[model samples]
Target: MAMLNKGDTAALVCCSNGLRPSEKQRIDTLADILGDMGIRTAVSAVMYAASTHYAGTGKKRAEAFMELYCRKDVRAVFDVSGGDLANEVLPHLDYGIFIREPKPVFGYSDLTVLLNAVNASAGMETYLYQIRNLTGACGDRQREEFYRTAMGGSACLYDFEFKFLRGSGMEGIMAGGNIRCLLKLAGTPWWPDFAGKLLFLESRSGDAAKMATYLCQLEQTGALDKVNGILLGTFTQMEEEGCRPRIEELVLNITEKRGVPVAATPQIGHGSDSRCLILGRNYCLNLQGKTL
Candidate 1:
């Protein structure tokens, strides 16, 4: 049980048990670093094992996380790691707790499942940003800028750069994370209502065409068409092979054709230096590229 004051951030070491002994050290190191910086952290081996996509870690760990969430000392919550299995925990989680006590929940990639599900179910604000495991990236100016921009807002406002693709700046509730994870939400009850949102999405590495397909699915679900704007965060480090249509081309062509204001690359998701995005809230995206 970790204690955090109003401004203090609480770190949650939710993993999928796929980590090795040395990787555990990495998580511990992260906790220490955050602690040194005055952030509170808690480590739970249960969620680590539960995060594995195919690990089948089960409801026990998810229940444990829910219990931790009920703690009164917790301020902001962040996942210590991402794995393949957070989607499994979504249904099992006491998601109502998040709505009753809204706090920042931060994580990218696999944590997207939890973030999306909770936001949609509870109508609470969540964050799409680096967790304790990767906050060291805060040393970077661009990264820090992204985090601060989103956090500084009283109700989730973003002041990051947006590369204009077709439309202009628009404000709406933000909902999106790892593109792959968003696609996985298809046809699921956990999938949130993305209607009338300022959708933001970023990916690390994957098949570009498949990404397009996923985007199309968002369109089919009315998520894309329902958004006031679309912001594409950093897609970072693509595989040398097996990525087709090229992400840039696919994204640009699709978003432009969809007739939605599209902005790309200001940094967010799965990169050594990931930016921050606030989900399930409203924000204004001003897309510009001028150096100071």
Candidate 2:
């Protein structure tokens, strides 16, 4: 993949959810921020197009994506926000176009479905980051990390301490996104193939019990059996009493028994200091060394 150089254009696409009246301000704000970084921004028509809770109809959203992908000026694509409807646009996307013209696509949360799908179907690399907060006044770190990752510069260092739960040294292609969103692809062709892969799981919201149930579902479906290791990202709003324990116990039960390396950090999901993770890339997760 080529680096996004000065004056390069990035497309701001809204796939899952429509922008609210207040969020329209973010479009201009993000553009200014990108401009300051020597990058230009182009807002997708679907950002303003609405059909109930979705940014637009599936076909409309897919068209917006295709337009950006096919544009000679556009070097990258960023989802404006994540919501429950991203999967609707999946079947409408032309993966063949991406195969011929691959570029970085960025988002997290509900956009996980698209992130993993694009990589699996089109063989393009996707990034996991929160796009909406990248330009805020207090987001300097995130802004810098995004610049570095998107521009193909140095790797974004994860600063949080990761508790090594099992195994030793491990290396595999980094995979996974929002856990709940990933589950949506279970029986579909879009479901990620985790064989010999480092699986990273994160969530924006959910109780421990609910998370345990989701993990159980993954275990039952044999999704947990094929991965080389597991990296747990920040689980926001899931720290209620007994919730963290159940979630940890479930992961430990599955990974530890299998001798799969496992670790956790509160810096990769919905948190303010979330780091950028490049999906479909090879990375080494060292449990004893506490690095990735």
Candidate 3:
């Protein structure tokens, strides 16, 4: 495991493509928290590129992020916020540079675009967790654990509780993130090969039937057939009325035919409670272990 060395630093890349002043302050709070954890960090200006007001800054935004990617001193890259421009910067990214100098990358939502692209192109594992542009939500233990797993290089234990909906114990390389993000990459060269892996996923605000529809898409694309198991995070701010079935019940229904061990409501996704998950890394989700 490549742990964060005693004097190592973490580079903060805010995907601000466009950000509010309040958002900037949130990124600063993230930096301060990391600093308190004794990890050195650098806050770059990828923030401005995310706003509708900054449509013309795409070229400059890519250049800035590319520059940070090349810096040897940067041990890891953390995104500040996620919006729309990440896809714009995708084609401009140098995957070869990241491969040559691989480091753990972290962020979610819009960052999902970047994570899937990098993993597809460079074969380096990335993280899907709390965004850097949020404040006062994550606790210290969560922060320390996340950094420890991400920068404290080396495989760590990850046995989070899966409110088992149908199947039982299983283990494999973990993959999958935001439901929409995963679906977006479908049919693209960037879509991950999920065969024989644990396909962990969660979403925000979608009701059970909508969740079922997305899972069906994954199944139609043969994504479901590739997993060794399934783990779901809470659907934050989920609505009760959608003329659809219950979300958890829907998940149980989808995976029942696959007969794969399925777990639900694990500590993850679109909430302050979202825990860190290493994409492309091997993990075990079982009983009597580190159940979240």
Candidate 4:
């Protein structure tokens, strides 16, 4: 069912880090684009707020998120910022508030922490996508998909491209994104169950060394062993900078002979043309399948 009507409000939240002065334009552009689709925006109060490196204290950020969820006028919540501070707001989140008449919650990168937590605790659908992406080079398609699915209440159509890295026929509930951000759930109450889940990963920034270390840690947690397969998305900075020890190479070494199915796509992650992916849902993937 459609979560929004033509005149309903969709919220833009910054539950991670404060926006830089210039990023405000980016937000405006996003709102204008959505406005063209007849959806009004209700930006969160704490979006531009800051306390040194964060949007605010964890308590404040959590409160802002809860407030948005509780608003009857808000049809959906979209987080617009990405920073290392996202996980800090996790503990302060009142999971119960999310259960009452839940709306679709959307985010990506560090927002992964929020997406998975809500899915695990509240069983509400969450999106692993950056709303700012609507201003990107792929804006047209992004906006199309957003309107068709989120606003129109139609099923999703996978429009990105991918190629297999290990094996084929990887299928299971989608979980994980931005390896570093996902790992923040470790030892926390919100950590997702990995058993038979299709682990998806992408990155906005992080070098080969950082990825190697992250994979090592995740491997040690035995998550790798429990997942049904793995899917790699664009490793933006590393891919653009031509960083050595490419993510695919390191992943191959880390799982050497483990027989985990793996695939990759440059059409997702922080790419200019990145597409959206749904979290906490059963997905059957292949080089050609279009619907998830």
Model number with the top TM-score = 4
Best by lDDT: 4
Model 3 score (lDDT): 0.69
Worst 10 residues of 3 by lDDT: 153-162
lDDT measured at residue 243 in model 2 versus the true structure, 0 to 100:
62
lDDT of 2 by residue, 54-152 (tens): 667888988998898789999888897777889989999999988998888888898999999999997788888767667654488778776776565
Of 1 and 2, the candidate ahead on lDDT is 2
Question: What lDDT score goes with residue 187 in model 4?
Answer: 84
Which regions of candidate 1 fall more than 4 Å away from where they truly are? Answer: 1-9, 15-17, 47-56, 133-159, 239-244, 255-257, 287-292
Candidate 1 matches the true fold with a TM-score of 0.82
Models 1 onward score TM values of 0.82, 0.92, 0.84, 0.93
Q: Flag clash pairs in model 4.
A: none
lDDT of 3 at 134: 35
What is the C-alpha lDDT profile of model 1 across 36-65, one tens digit per residue?
555667655454333433323547657767
Q: Can you give the lDDT of residue 246 in candidate 3? A: 60
Model 4 lDDT-worst window of ten: 153-162
Q: Quantify all predictions' global Cα lDDT against the true fold.
A: 0.65, 0.80, 0.69, 0.83
| Tens-digit lDDT track of model 4 for 13-82 | 8888788766788899899998998999988778775336566777888888888878888888899888
TM-score of 4: 0.93
Ranking by lDDT: 4, 2, 3, 1
Model 4 whole-model lDDT (C-alpha atoms): 0.83
Please say which candidate is ahead in lDDT: 3 or 4. 4
